[model samples]
Target: MAKKQDNTITWDTFSEGLWRENPVFVMLLGMCPVLAVTNSAINALAMGIATLFVLLASGTLISLLRNSIPKQVRIATYIVIIATFVTIVDYTIQAISLDLYNALGAFIQLIVANCMILGRAEAYSSRNPPLKSIVNATGMGLGFTLALLCLGVVREILGAGSLFGIDLFGPRFEPWVVMVLPAGGFLVLGAWLLLFEWLKQRKSETELNPASES
Candidate 1:
């Protein structure tokens, strides 16, 4: 019984963040970056990729040293490891493109302070194996990215009448300027949450009365 209870599957760890415990939509852990950079699809994509890299790297390292880390300073130690990855990502972005680096700005460095990363480090990775930790981190990162994209798409389309900086609608379309503003972030997020809840309820109803549908 002990053995069975203690065991975990790698795939389970990876899939949990997809829907069951999504960092952005479900868990709502890292809102700062999500709301700040999601005005455009490209910005959201850049932020997502940068976050994914640091999360996987830090989670792997932290899991590898879980047994050795002193309980007295585990939080501090995790911060250092996370900061190291953030630094790497920061410089890499700067080297790649000055414009992108300027766009993402301090949010890249602020990944160290993102509760989602640290939460996963302490809650899942620290207790799991390196492979499991990386998988879980990847799942969570992907979930966050997907959520960002959802908002980015809607805002970019409505606010700028474009996607990825290319105009989808001709000059006749009037963009909703508010969609690009900070308030648009809240509005979009709230709409998503409402949709998620509605779908969840529909699923629940289907499950509760499966015979009727058949």
Candidate 2:
């Protein structure tokens, strides 16, 4: 079991989500949307923002009502709260851009099932005050967004020879069709995971080797 945090709020409470506990790279939560809708940069951004809003809004509401929620039905209650925000996101996206809505498909609605948001609610938000929960959720949301963009931008550029639908390479350049495919998501995600792991390993080695410091 994880240690429970105190009421005190610190920078680490928020910043941990950005890198140390990134939902995608570090913690590996919510990979469904991460891989499914990240073929294009625009799609990835939209999904990330939607999930962020849900995380923040739900975290706030859950923190405020944490005491009242019965322990027996807490999980069910959390889902209800999460689903409400997801519904709002669903309708808003439909009104904003039909093309984007189609591109994202059912993944947007599936945000309700994202363990990252639920985990925050059950583990963090339910224990902390609203203010602290908001800060933590913001950091986590941004981290998830950053991870999605990393994959999306790379996939889009290599797959379509463009970013956010804007052409970068001319007609002469051939796009790597695999980058935009489902296999592309797996390939890119594996590559990113390897890179982060390598960096972490190198950092650990540096810390252990006192001689290298000299």
**TM-score top scorer:** 2
lDDT of 1 at 77: 96
Candidate 1 wrong stretches, greater than 4 Å:
1-10, 209-214
What does candidate 1's lDDT look like per residue over 1-214, in tens digits?
A: 0122243565767777877788898888899999999999999999999999989999999999999999999999999999999999999999999999898889999988999999988887778888777878899899889888999999999999999999999999999999999999999999999999999788878796746532
- Per-prediction TM-score to the true structure, in the order listed: 0.93, 0.95
Q: What is the lDDT of every predicted structure here? A: 0.89, 0.93
Query: How good is model 2 by TM-score?
Result: 0.95
CA shift of 15, model 2, Å: 0.6
Q: Report residue 202 deviation for candidate 1 (angstroms).
A: 1.7
Q: Candidate 1 clash total?
A: 0
Which residue pairs show collisions in model 2?
A: none
Candidate 2: how many backbone clashes?
A: 0
